[model samples]
Target: MIITKAKPIEEILPFLEGKERIFLVGCNVCAAKMKTGGEPEVLALFDYLTGLDYNVIGWAVPTAACSVRSYESLVEKNEKLKEADCVLVMACGSGTSVIASILDLPVTGTNDTLSLGGQIGSSAINHLCSLCGDCNIGDYSGICPNACCPKSQINGPCGGSKNGMCEVSKTSECVWYIIEKRMKTVQTLPILNKIKPPKDHFV
Candidate 1:
């Protein structure tokens, strides 16, 4: 799932100014799971906009907002999508791009894309795999400190790791401790002790 956070209404309202007829598009996949761009969220935003005297033309919360073909099909079926002065996509940043690509209208994003999610728990999802396009999981004992750690230290933990929790985020577990514990259990502790050179990004 692609985790997302709702942009504050204050920021959204400013961008929406001077745009009378507005169309809303919400995602039913990742954004819906986060409760930021689902059907309920779209209707909630619709009601809010109606209260603010914004002429909302129409809205749609489809199953996949990132699919360009699906979006074009949706637009073909719903004339309101093309009739609106501006489109406010209630999904991730990529959903906005999908809408803009199909429609010639002024399209923009409502929710801010956060990260590729491993678990859907909080408004900000817990991330495990960053999809860095590099597979170094074996070296890190299947734990990615470089992705979860604020410091992004590939080698090991920094001085900030104390009491098995990260200094940056107290709720976050210390990644180095997790890696070492995992390595020891697998009898790969000796391999972990070996120093590694910098990652070759070209690879």
Candidate 2:
């Protein structure tokens, strides 16, 4: 799932400065799961904007605002959207961009895209994969050194890690250290001996 954080009101105010007849679009998937742009959130924002003397024409929480077809369907079904002079999308950057591309009016996002991560108990965790096109996590006990390591070290630790912590960020544990420990626990430490080819950044 894509992780996202809601933008503060101070930042969102600027986008609505001279705009009236606003329409809000929220996502029921990633944004909803994060409690950023769910149905309740969109309605609360609608009331807040109304109290501030802004004419909030309508609001909709689509199944997935990132989908062009879903958003287009909502737009076609809701005639009030045609009256909107501005659109405030409470989804990720991709959803906002897709809406903006489909609409002639000004479109803005109310959330900041954090990362392509997943939900873990009540928190979100960033994945080790950076989507580098060449996946080799299977060779390293399902951990990708390209993303977890600050230096993107694929072969092994840079020898700068001490006490299992990274030299670059003393507070964060070295991913290589975690990988090694995990491999040891699984009795697969010998797999680390295989040389990994350098990542093809162009991919």
Candidate 3:
């Protein structure tokens, strides 16, 4: 599931302030279950706007607004959307782009699109290893130092490592600790003794 956060209603109102006809487009894909762009969220936003005395002409929720085929039906039903001042999309960035391509109306994002993962516990994502394109975990026994390291070092641990904890924060797990554990498990602890050159910051 793609994680997302809703934009504030105050942030969304300026676009439709003076417009007589406005449409609030919600997505049933990512934002629905996440409660960011579902029917309930849209209705709540519509009610807020009506309370503020803004003319909200109509609203609709389409299944997977990012899908080109799904948007075709939305376009059919909301032909009047063409006449709308703006189309406020509550989908991810990609979905907003898809909606803009099919509709001539100006598109605005109502959700802050986050990473393509689900929540694990405490509203935080688990195993958030942002694959930064260059991977060099083969020597480290498949453990990502880029993610585990507090400084995001790919070579060896910095001078600030203290008792298997990062110097930046005590909460962070040291990358070298994880690397050493992996090496020992694989019976390749001897590899840790080898000197690793400084990582190229550009790469």
lDDT of 3: 0.75
Ranking by lDDT: 2, 1, 3
**Which portions of model 1 miss their true places by more than 4 Å?**
120-125, 185-188, 200-203
In the order shown, what is each candidate's alpha-carbon RMSD?
Answer: 2.5, 2.1, 4.4
Q: Assess each prediction's global lDDT (C-alpha) against the native.
A: 0.82, 0.87, 0.75
TM agreement with the true structure for every prediction: 0.87, 0.87, 0.68
User: Which order, best to worst by TM-score?
Assistant: 2, 1, 3
lDDT of 2 by residue, 14-131 (tens): 8998897999999999899888899999999999999999999998887888886744577776789989999999999988887888889999999998766777798877654677
Model 1 TM-score (2 dp): 0.87
Better of 2 and 3 by lDDT: 2
Off by over 4 Å in 3: 119-152, 155-203
Could you tell me which 10 consecutive residues in candidate 2 have the lowest summed lDDT?
68-77
Clash list (residue pairs), candidate 3: none
- Candidate 1: pairs in clash: none
Residue 23 of model 1 has an lDDT of 93
